[model samples]
Target: MERIDRRLGLLFALPVSAILAGAFLAPLLVVAIFSTMPQKVFDFLHWPDFSSYRVILEQGYWRSILWSLGLAFTATALLLVICWPLAYGMARVFGRFTLVLTVLVVMSLFVSENIRLFGWFLTLMKGGLIEGHLRAWFGQGFEGLLFNVPAILFGLVYVYLPFMLFPLAQGIAMVPDDARAAAFDLGASRWQVFTQIELPLAAPGIMVGSLLTFVLSAGAIAEAKLLGGRAVIVIADDIETAFTFAQNWPLGSALSMVLIAVVGTLVILGLRRVDLDAIMGRRR
Candidate 1:
């Protein structure tokens, strides 16, 4: 009877396992294949060469790379700063309000990122809401504010806030009430307790959330296009240019591989620092 039950469970799991292998694993195999191919090669897919990777390593791609890294880190930093207090508040102070707040966050997440950028574009344009306020205060309006690095950064944070908030709040939720009480009982200042105890316990979740925000912001194209106004040439826009105008699939593919390499390397480094047990415990 036990053997029959085990066989039945395997039968149920087989289809989902096979779909995962075929749908996801197969494309990864193709990416691995193409990452090693030459710039002009077409007919031969099996041939292995490091030429594509070499070009990626030894070329002007470095500038775009630095730009991506800078944007990603900046976005990560902003996300942490903005979400930390909100997440802590949600976990500690807003028990009955948590569901309502979570619903709003999820709704914002559902709104398309491109659409959000569009909304900001209109909002930042001259005579818009923000512009009206600035015009009243400083007399010089939103012209300088729109189509700049600041707007692009704003769009990035707006789009990625929930991603950072959700995980961080969950992390804070996992901290023992007793730990917080004990800290208070020992006469630790609020700042001291948060900095020393809460933040350390929440580190793993913060890392995961920040990594997500970083990767998303790094690859973002629409925000730079709509907000930066061609002034800033991000790596993602370069890839789009390669694909659309240059019509260079090989170069575009190569560009994408560089992004993949950079992001994958960061993720691997982060994974190495995370304790698996701690991560699982946070989920509980």
Candidate 2:
């Protein structure tokens, strides 16, 4: 029976694995090959000169890379702070209210992301909703909020809130209420209980949430472009410009490869805290 079950599992997994490889891995493989080739090459099979990487160094594109990393880090940290309390409420305190909150968050995703962002644009742009109303009512209005770093960060936080919230709630839910009560009974302060007991137990969920938020924020272009008004050019912008505007496949591929390398390393590190077997209900 065990052997039959194992075989069935493999059989079921084969098609999904094949689809992943073809649909996901194939393009990555192509980009990897292209990254090694010389510039302006129509074929990825061209000789491996690695000149595109040189252009990245010589042309000083590190600013965009730094901007991308900084924004992503900031956004991820902010989401962690913002979601922790809400997630805790949803996981432990809300009871029946959790369903309502989850539905609201999920419903937001049903709208096009661009449309939602554009709505913010209309509100934050100069002489737009907030400013116009404030000026009309009180004769007090600042120079709009969009086209700034803070606005981009706000967009990142808004868009990725659900990603962080659900994972954190799941993580916090896994923490036993009895354990928290026991800690309180033992005269442990709230801060001590949180740091020593709650945080360690919730590490897996926190890691997953932070990793997702960081990687997505790092690669995001729409926030910077739409909300920031090009106040900052992120690494994704550089890659897109290379590929589309500059028509430089090798350079774009190289930039992409760098991003993949950076994000992949962090993902691997973050994933170390998570237990897949436990998550899958197969823990020994």
Candidate 3:
């Protein structure tokens, strides 16, 4: 019976495995191959060269790369700080009110991300909603709110907050109520209970959420384009420019592969703390 079940599982997984290989892995392989080939060449038969990678190392690409890393790290840190309290409240303190908040969070996911970003764009634009109101009331408003670093950061946080919040809430929810009670019974203060017990137990969620948020933020092109304008340039923007405007396939592929490596490393690190069974809701 177990053998039959195993066979069935494998059979069911075949389609998904094939799809991943064909759609994802195959393309990644192509990109890797292209990254090694001569610039502007689409043919895979060309001899591999390290010139593209050397160009990346020698050129001003570091500025965009560093900017991407800095933005991603900053956004991830801010997200953790913002989401931790909210997630804890939703998981433990909010009780019945948590249901409404959860529904709202999930509903936000149903809306198109681009539409939400565009809404932010409108609100931040000069003489737009917030700026117009502020100017009316105070006779002064932030003229540089749109097309700046803060706008990009705000957009990233708004879009990715729910991603961090969900995992954090889930992790916090898994902490037993009895554990908190026991901590209190042992004369631990609320802060101690949260810092030592809740936060430690929620490490898996923190790792996973940080990984997701950071990688997504680093690879974001739309947010930078729409909100940052020409003031900010991230690695994703550089990659897009190389692929589209520059028409340098090898350079673009090299940049993409670097991003893939960074994201992949983060995923591996997060997997160390993540409970796969808990995430998947699978039986051990």
Candidate 2 displacement at residue 246 in angstroms: 0.7
Pairs in steric clash, model 1: none
Whole-model Cα lDDT of every candidate shown, in order = 0.80, 0.92, 0.86
Q: Which pairs in model 3 have colliding backbones?
A: none
Off by over 4 Å in 1: 1-13, 40-49, 57-59, 132-142, 275-284
Residues 1-284 of candidate 2: C-alpha lDDT, one tens digit per residue: 99999999999999999999999999999999898899978696678999988988888887888899999999999999999999999999999999999999999999988899999999998799999899999998889999999999999999999999999998898788999999989999999899989998888788888998999999999999999999999999999999998999999999999888988988898788788555443435
Model 2 TM-score relative to the real fold: 0.93
lDDT of 1 by residue, 75-190 (tens): 88999998988998898898889889999989876878888778888788777778878899988764646777777888788888888998888778777889988998999899
Ten contiguous residues minimizing lDDT sum, candidate 2: 275-284
> Residues 20-49, candidate 3, lDDT per residue (tens digit)?
999999999999999998887767888998
For lDDT, the strongest prediction is 2
> Model 1: which ten-residue window has the lowest total lDDT?
38-47
Ranking by lDDT: 2, 3, 1
RMSD of each candidate? 3.0, 2.1, 2.3
Whose lDDT is higher: candidate 1's or candidate 3's?
A: 3
